[model samples]
Target: MSPYKGNRKINIPISIFVVVFAFILLVIPTSGNTEQLITLDKQKLPHKFSIAAPEIRPLVYIDKQGNIAGQFITMFEHFSEQTGIKVDIKVMPWGRAVQQAKSGNSDAIMPALYTNERAAFFAYPSEPLVIFSGSVVLQHRQDTRKIDSWHDIHDSQIVKVRSMNLGENVGRLFVNNRNELVEVVRIVDGLQMLQHKRVDYVVMDALIASSLIEELKLQDEIKVIVHPEESRLSNSYLAFSTSFAAQFDVEKIMALINQYNDPDKYIKQLEIYSH
Candidate 1:
């Protein structure tokens, strides 16, 4: 049907072309352009930042040479190397760590448990360094106070790391008897208090409790109760301060962190970190 015979012209609506162009734009991304966009995002992230980390064994702690070295520390190192974002670990007391993070003095804090108070300033990631199970520690087998269950410690003098939120079950007792619970700057100090009869129980991470007791030569003195298999367990995460989150994309950084997270590889890097 020679419809376009001898120099004939056909007119088409411009709107159809516009609609087709938009559909292409919505469905497809040019390969090189997409790579450039990703590179731009990574480039925008801060080159370096200080992460306030409390000295907790098997996770983060000051080594003999006075450098923060542990599973979490190694994780930061790996992340920095892979993402080109340097994360400096600043070892400090738990109280001071959160304080620095809140004041915008530090960009983030690591291996922290969640608390309603902390949610105000910190944005937590899904990847965690450790899962801490609460253990009721009593000084010397003779001191005589039973912690068959959490309720048993309602009246006991309990001391845990200051501002460290173990879990709701452990927290309820503290809320009920604020005076009975003493806050300490370090796990070592709490264990020391427990030994000196200054505190009746030092409730903290099971593995950390045993590790410190052995390190402090208190194995003969400190008794750890790991009963009531359902001890309050909390996963510790790398919490980013609000100021840092506002400065850059928190979720993007977190995605980078999680991308490298292989739980087995995590503990393997620290060779000795387990449970």
Candidate 2:
């Protein structure tokens, strides 16, 4: 027997494939919602991710353009461009920002100071994303009782950003009056309160406070009360919600951060924006 040339077989009609494809198109949306969505695919799609942070001036803030702009935001934006993971930044009060992470409403929080209290709720990367010095406690220039040392703070009323841990330990020890160590929601609010003599001193980073003071035109009024003996060196890390940490690889994210984060340049950008 020779080779038999055969053409007769089950002819899968192209119309069937067309019908299946049309069904898929209806079942799945190509893009309808977010600006970052590459596709609305189910099995193969990249999911949207978000982060929250306190509006700490110069480091993380809502710029004059009403857009979230700062060091950490810039770093994540670069990461998003490289990795296709959309990073949404929510700038809120420090307390609410922490709450956002704890409740898993935000995927992560960044530039957060490490605390045993916070460690209980947020998962931090092994290394810090930012290390900064020059914490300052401000007093109005007119009220000018010198505060060059911890001894100088005396019985003065001071304001601390509530839900923030930096220098709070010392405040508890030094501030004899419980009511004297007032708490505020935002740093800008604290500075403004200090401006109006609502509080005698408002504690924050010297550089950050200066920028905000200039913006509010309170530069001439509020003066930094420096105490090198009580100088604070802070380390801030990218922290994720417990569930979100489990979802992503922490080391990979940290590597991306290290690649993109530049503190010196970030400061320059802040200066540019201030001008």
TM-score of each: 0.69, 0.73
User: What is residue 141's positional error in candidate 1, in angstroms?
Assistant: 1.9
lDDT of 2: 0.69
Off by over 4 Å in 2: 1-48, 168-174, 230-232, 263-275
Tell me the lDDT of model 1 at 242.
87
lDDT of each: 0.70, 0.69
- For residue 93, give model 2's deviation from the true position in Å: 2.4
Query: Which regions in candidate 1 have their CA more than 4 angstroms from the true location?
Result: 1-44, 145-147, 172-179, 227-229, 259-275
- Model 2, 122-155: lDDT tens digits are 8888767776564667778888475555555656
Superposed by TM-score, candidate 2 places the C-alpha of residue 272 at a distance from the truth, in angstroms, of 20
Give every collision pair in model 2. Answer: none
